[model samples]
Target: MSGSESSAPAGQAAPEALSFTVHSMPQPSLADRRSRVLGGRLRLLLVLLACAAPVIASYFTYYVIRPDGRTNYGTLIQPSRGWPADLALQAIDGAAVAPAALRGQWLLVTVGDAACDASCEKHLYMQRQLREMLGRERDRVDRVWLITDGGTPAQALREAVEATGPVWMLRVDRAVLARWLAPADGQALGDHLYIVDPMGEWMMRMPADPTPQQVKRDLDRLLRASSSWDRAGRE
Candidate 1:
């Protein structure tokens, strides 16, 4: 064997030495990791805010931007009550109506028995008139008659409702209806007209026997204020 080579077994090949190279990877700093996490959370928050912008802008217009400098005639419902998801409403034709489907337009709602007495008729008339008075803005409002009774509505009531073009005639349980809509002092739910915003929030209640002019003023203000965010029809 040469001096530089070590001898092994006479017939066996020599084994080669193994070599390894170590390379260290840099770990992210705590501040860098925290900044990345914070950036992701901030992005998620911004997306949520963007989704809620329309609702927030509408409310801001109603509460903050009073163009006419006149107070709302309808009593404002602070922290407005949202439409009940479990209402199980039914259309006049007995079709299932989803509460979510009622969103995306202003709602002028009236509650009463299927009989639709004189008071009910009067409120329905006012609802129709108020919507009509909006003229070009009329498409922005929807009239809803929530029949609390179970039986079929009276033929006269049905005919009257049909006369009001595109009115949403729906039936809801009286007990459930009461939980969402209320009347003024010494009055029934049938006495007042409820104002639901485009977002399905019951935000205002017109007084019992409200004057047409007064109700129009309130409706006008809402329509005008929400013009920036609210559109004419439901999505």
Candidate 2:
């Protein structure tokens, strides 16, 4: 037998085999990738809006759905001013307190000397009564007495303040306070009761020597307006 012819048995065939090649998918272009990312972001934003719809709708019902001619008892400060961060302030215990720390709740602020005269007592009384009138919502409003002078508050005044409930007795510079809380024309800061919103904007100012009934109406409106968003306490 010849060397090449004798390699396989007669009439026998070589085994057959099959093979395949795999091709990877093409990569996405930059524009396509950006569009996919934007689509995901839009979906996330839509979910957030759905979660916040109740709060947004409640505010819309109070502010936009109301009649255009309605008037508020308190004067709305045009171009609302925010609390000053740099103002020097201290608590009754002589501990330093940042002015901005007073945010996150409604504030009824009265500014005067530490001596606290009769007029000052009257203002403090009105503040306490107004908050108590709120019932369950009283926690949402805080009473703030900003003493502008260096003298410590009198013992009697301190006792009276404590009897009124929680009062944030903070001492601030007189000149610095004048820049933020202003009185009506022909009046002083002590003459008016200032209202600060939960977000720290000084939004309203009650008239000098305002009647409790009128102030109550204004506060009721505010509480109703903010019911959906403002909770009863700070963090």
Candidate 3:
């Protein structure tokens, strides 16, 4: 043994050569970069469609092809409309009502002056009957009477409206309302009962003096088709 080896500690051996592993850093080419981008986009698209599926399905069933294949009695509003952000709405007591408050339930809306004319009275009765006819599904719906002026409805009239179920009477500007709902050509806005979906979009407008039986058929189909959809109950 060499002199240095002999002088080393008893258990010590000569120094061994150090070894290292060399790895090539990943350098993605153009195709690899494109693939990654495409993958990310596809994932995003899938997520969006998943979130929108229920809404799309419900709307399609009502607007496009009904399962029973029967045409709707009410006129479908194409590219449905929502309450205008600037629309000034107030409760019966004149408290400000946020537009967001109107969302999250089916709204059967009626528009008229607070004087309770015959046409207005008939519509109020029809609204109640339509809701009652829904049976258990009645709980999923609500009635909104938009009074276009500052006048309060007669006590008897309000009582009649609430005799069966509560009606939301809000004072709204008639001009502002024109931006959210409209009537058939040559007809007044109060002449039609408007159907607003849970998302607050105006979806349907009843014919002038709509028949309860025909309207009931539409409501039945709507409630049936949307059985899967739900929201927080009656806020």
Best candidate (score: lDDT): 3
Inter-residue clash pairs, candidate 1: none
Cα error of candidate 1 at position 219, Å: 0.8
Error of 3 at 132 (Å): 0.8
- After TM-score superposition, what is the CA distance of residue 200 in candidate 2 from its true location, in Å? 1.6
lDDT of 2 at 29: 98
lDDT of 1 by residue, 104-210 (tens): 99999998888888898999999888988999999999999999988777777677766858888899998887778888889888999999988788999999988
Candidate 3 residue lDDT tens string, 51-82: 88888898788777876677889998888998
Residue lDDT tens for model 2, 18-118: 88999999999999999999999999999999988865675465455755656778888877788666678988788998776777788998888888888
Candidate numbers, best TM-score first, in rank order: 3, 1, 2
Instruction: Please identify model 2 stretches exceeding 4 Å from their true place.
Output: 1-25, 40-64, 67-69
Comparing candidate 1 with candidate 2, which one achieves the higher lDDT?
1
- When sorted by lDDT, best at the front, the candidate numbers are 3, 1, 2
Candidate 1 TM-score, true structure as reference: 0.84
Model with the higher lDDT, candidate 1 or 3 = 3
TM-score of each model, paired residue for residue:
0.84, 0.79, 0.85
